[model samples]
Target: MRISLICIGKTDESYLNMGIEKYVNRLKHYVNFTLTIIPDIKNTKNLTQEQQKSKEAEQLLKQINATDTVVLLDERGSIFKSIDFAKYLDKKMISSTQHLVFIIGGPYGFDNSMYDRAQSKLSLSSMTFSHQMIRLFFIEQLYRAYTILRGEPYHHE
Candidate 1:
C-alpha cells in the first residue's frame, strides 16, 4: 500500500526538516511513503479561526482521492501503543488499501467538512504539540511501526 502524510504549512526548522528527511529516506525500504505539504493560509490575522480552517479544508480535500482511506490526526482520536499501531497498519495493508492518507490539519485544527470526510482519527498523545513538531513525531512513529513489523532492532518493547 502507498502511505501518504499530508500536512498543512511548511516545517521551517532545519533540525525538524533534517529529521523528517532522515525517516523519509528510511521509509523507502519498507513502504511507498510520500509527504505532501499544503501551504499555510495567508493573512490569517484577518480571518476567524473557523474561516481559516474552512479554507485549509478546501486545499486539504483536493489532495485526497475518493478511494483513499483518510485518517485525521486529531486530539480526540484513538491512542495506540507502538505494537498496536504496527498491527493496525498491517491490517490496512492486508485489506488491500491502495492509498492510506494521514492528515495533519492547520494550527486551528480541521473544519467540520474535513472531519466528516475522514474514515478514522488517531492521536499521538494526550499532550499537545506544535503542528510542525508533530510532523517529525508522527513520521518517526511510522518508522518505528515499520521496524516493529519487520522485527528490526530499531524498536524496543
Candidate 2:
C-alpha cells in the first residue's frame, strides 16, 4: 500500500527538517511514502481560530482522494504502542489498502469537516507537541515501526 503524510504548513526549523528527511529517506526502502506540505494560510492575524481551521481543512481535503483511507493525528485519538502500530500497518497492507493518508493539522487543529473525512485517528502521545516537532517525531516513529516489522535492531523493547 502507498502511505502518505499530509500536513499543513512548512516545518521552519532546519534541525526538524533534517530529522524528518532522515526518516523519510529510510521509509522509501519499505513503502511508497510521500510527504505533502500544504501551504499555511496567509494573514492569520485577522482570522478567528475556527476560520483558520476551516481554510486549512479546505486545502487538506483537496489532497485526499475518495479511495484514500484518511487518519488524523489528533491528541484525543487512539494511542498505540510502537509494536502495535506496526501490526496495525501490517493489517492494512495485507487487506490491500490502496492509499493510507495520515494528516497533521494546523496549530489550532483540524476543523469538523476534516474529522468527518477521516476513517480513524491516531495519537502519538498524550503530551502536546509543537506541529513542527511532531513532523520529526511522527516520521521517526514510522521508521521505527517499519524496523520493528522487519525484526531489525533499530527498535528496542
Candidate 3:
C-alpha cells in the first residue's frame, strides 16, 4: 500500500527538514511513503476560526482521492505503541489499500466535515505540539514503526 502524509503548511526550520528527510529516505526501505504539503491559507487576520478551518479543509479535501483511506492525526485519537502502529500499517497493506492518507490539519484543527470523512484517527501523544513540529515527529515515528516491524535495533520496548 502507498502511505501518504498530508499536512497544511510547510516546516521552515532547516533542522526539522533534515530530520524529516532522514526518515523519509529510511521509510523507502520498508514501504511506499510520501509526504505531501498543502500550501498555507492566505490572509487569516479577518477570518473566524471556523472560517479558517473551512478554508484549510477545502485544500485538504482536494488532495484526497475517493479510494484513499483518510486518517486524521488528532490528539484525541487512538494512541498506539510503535509495534502496534507497524502492525496497523501491515494490516492495511495486507488488505490491499491503494492509498492510505494521513492528514495533519491546520492550526485551528479540522472541520466537522473532515472529521466525518475520516476512517480513523491517531494520536502521536497526549501533549500538544505545533503543527510544524508534528511533521517531524510523525515521520520519525513512522520510521520507528517500520524498524520495529522488521526487528531492527532502532526501536526499544
TM-score of each: 0.99, 0.98, 0.97
- Which segments of model 3 are wrong by more than 4 Å? none
lDDT of 2 at 85: 95
Off by over 4 Å in 2: none
Tell how far residue 34 is off in model 2, in angstroms: 0.2
Task: Identify the leading candidate in terms of lDDT.
Answer: 1
Q: What is the lDDT of residue 27 in candidate 3?
A: 91
**Considering lDDT, which of the candidate structures 2 and 3 is the better prediction for this target?**
2
For candidate 2, give the lDDT of residue 3: 94
lDDT of 1 at 146: 98
Model 2: lDDT equals 0.95
Model 2 lDDT tens row, 82-148: 9999999999999999999999999999999999999999999999999999889988998999999
Backbone clash pairs for candidate 2 read none
Return the TM-score for candidate 1, rounded to 2 decimals: 0.99
Which lDDT tens digits does candidate 3 get at residues 1-157? 7889999999999999999999899999988899999888889898999999999999899899988999999998999988899999889888999999999999989999899889999999999999989999999998898888788999877
- Position 43, candidate 2: lDDT: 100
- Quote the positional error of residue 73 for candidate 1 in Å: 0.4
